[model samples]
Target: MRTHFIAIGGAAMHNLALALHEKGYNVTGSDDAIFEPSKSRLQAKGLLPAEMGWFPEKITKDIDAIILGMHAKADNPELLKAQELGLTIYSYPEFLYEQSKNKTRVVIGGSHGKTTITSMILHVMHYHNVEVDYMVGAQLEGFDTMVRLTEDADFIVLEGDEYLSSPTDRRPKFHLYQPNIALISGIAWDHINVFPTYENYVEQFEIFISKITNGGILVYNENDPEVKRIAETAANPIRKIPYHTPEYSVENGTTLLETPEGPMPIEVFGAHNLNNLAGAKWICQNMGIDEADFYEAIATFKGASKRLEKIAESSKNVAYKDFAHSPSKVAATTKAVKEQYPDRTLIACLELHTYSSLNAEFLRQYEGALDNADVAVVFYSPDAVKIKQLEEVTYEQIAKAFNREDLIIYTNPVEFKDYLFNLKPDSNGMALLLMSSGNYGGLNFDEVKKLV
Candidate 1:
């Protein structure tokens, strides 16, 4: 197969490019700008464009397909050329569906915990030596690429993102999967730029539930009221399985699960993670994995990258970074840290970076999200607002929105860094949680590690 990619420098796009290149297909891609990691990885695999900008010549009649990334606009030069030539164009998710149509597709979707749920399923499958094709959002420890596809694998696990598939493809990415087994972790209104209303944002998930293949299974978190309502109303022929936080206890900062095999200790903690594990367990059971096997495999499952990932730790203090920008995620993450280390002085910092998080109307949903923290800090970049073409939000507006009168808010990255450095490490125990979808204005983890 000969495939061309437009806007191939994206995280998922580059990974897919490399995956196809490894499969011995002729792969070519173009992007205006390529950053580190994606740039180096693509170059190492000989998939990086020789030049930066798109070229009409790159799109040809012989190319079997064009995989379009979300980064590319509808008027992208290569995309226009492909359309002009009448070449087959596939959004990233659409192409993934096309490839795995014959396989038993398992899609994990929700506003939160999608990566963790997908990771757990993948970890268990790997532990049992189950051969499967997969596409997860984060880079796992044992997986070379975030995406994997093979002709022989009978199952495909997909991290079902609810975001728009591409600039031209308005449908949510998860809608195209047509899953035989689907899971919705929870529903929280997000992506304000696309679905402006809360009801509109939620309608996307309803569409996803309706799209499940006939007689398929739907495993969802029953704890989320919105998710419960959706599951109850779903008209599909799928078996509905609802899961909640399993039996677990935390002792001296260690979380242990009460499995049938015995009390199984795990490296990851938090009620949210425990809940994610429950959803994953049901999915694994559907895949023919027993409870004992799931427990054994999950014992070693740490977590997905940047989802409450531990960056640095010492006897005195521990620091974590997470890609949690939404209100529900922020509250859950903050509450988790406090629960895990009850004695610790929890300092939680969140970056209002995403479109929803930055929107004035959406910001009100964050009320009391950081209440569990002993000290709460919110950071936002004025320049980021300009870049996203959003309305400017002041520190007072954020503090008022969060309903935390004493909340410390910063618009400057250096000032925020200074505040973090000044936090005295509590001797008994202290936990620092940094949450954001984007790096807090180039705050280096390496530097933060040393400071913490």
Candidate 2:
């Protein structure tokens, strides 16, 4: 089959293109801007566009399907051309559903922990040599691509994001998957530009629960009241399973799981991860993995990239970067690092990058989010606010919202980096948590290492 992608250089889009290409389908794609990794990987596959930007002439009717990435605007010229010919145009999730219709689909969804849970299941599957097709948001250690679609794989694991599908679709991506089995870890209001209110944001998950196939299975975090409510009231007659945080203990800076088999030492730590671990276990168990096999595989799991990734470390100082801009995520990550190293001083820095986090109203949600850290810093770029076309927010506004008068806030990236570099931490009692969905004003990891 012949397939074309519009705005194909996205993390998910490029992976899907590669997946289709590996399956021997004739694939072509175009994007206005293609960044690193995606550009190089596509070039390596000989699948990179001859030139950047769209060409209306490339949208011929002979192409079997056009998969649209969220990166492309609704008025994109190639999209217009495709529509002119009455060719099928599908949002990323819609296309995924078309490909995996015959497979047993397991979709993991929520405001947080979806990526880690999905990665854990994938890791266990890979360890046990369980063959399945999958798509996860974050890059995993062994996985070559985030997406894998094949004819023979009977199961497909999907990280079901609640973000909008495409400019035209105007629906949450997860709603399109219609999973035979599903999981919603929790919900918190996000994407203030698109979903203006908490009620509006939560309605998407409700819709997701309603779309599950009849008699399908749903494994949820029983500890999360929102998830428990959604699972209980699902319109579909789903077989429900509830999971809580597993019994675990941190001893001498290493976290060990108290399992029925015995205490098993693990590379990954923290309460949020442990909660995700429990959910992953239930999902894996439903997919035919025995408890023994699951426990054996989970011991080696390091975690998904950038959830709480340690980028630089020395005896005196260590620093981590996390994709944690949302209020709940920021709070969870901050608390986790503090718990992991109780003896060390935790210095947590967060960036207000995403639409929701930057909003004036949403800033108040962050009250006490970083209270676990001994010293907390918040960074944001006014240039980024301009780029996202959101209203400008003031330092006073942020301070008032967070209700943290002692908080240090920086609008410039260079000054922020310099301040951190000059600190010259050699106390052996300090750890730094730099959290953001965007680069800290493009402050690279190389500069971060000099802190020690």
Q: lDDT: which candidate is best?
A: 1
TM-score to native of every candidate shown: 0.98, 0.98
> What are the per-residue Cα lDDT tens digits for candidate 1 across 1-452?
99999999999998888888887889998999999899999989878789999899868899999999998988998899999999999999999999999999999999999999999999999989998899999999888999998889999999999999998989999999999999999999888888988999999999999999999999999999999999988987889999999999998889999887667799889999999999999999999999889998999999999999999998878899999989999999999999998888999999999888888888899999999999899999999888988888877789799998789898999998888888887677789999999888989888878855
Candidate 1 ranges beyond 4 A from true positions = none
* Candidate 2 segments whose C-alpha is farther than 4 A from its true place: 426-428
As for candidate 1, its clashing pairs are: none
Going through the candidates in the order shown, the clash numbers are: 0, 0
Cα RMSD for candidates in order: 1.0, 1.1
Model 1, position 103, has a per-residue lDDT of 97
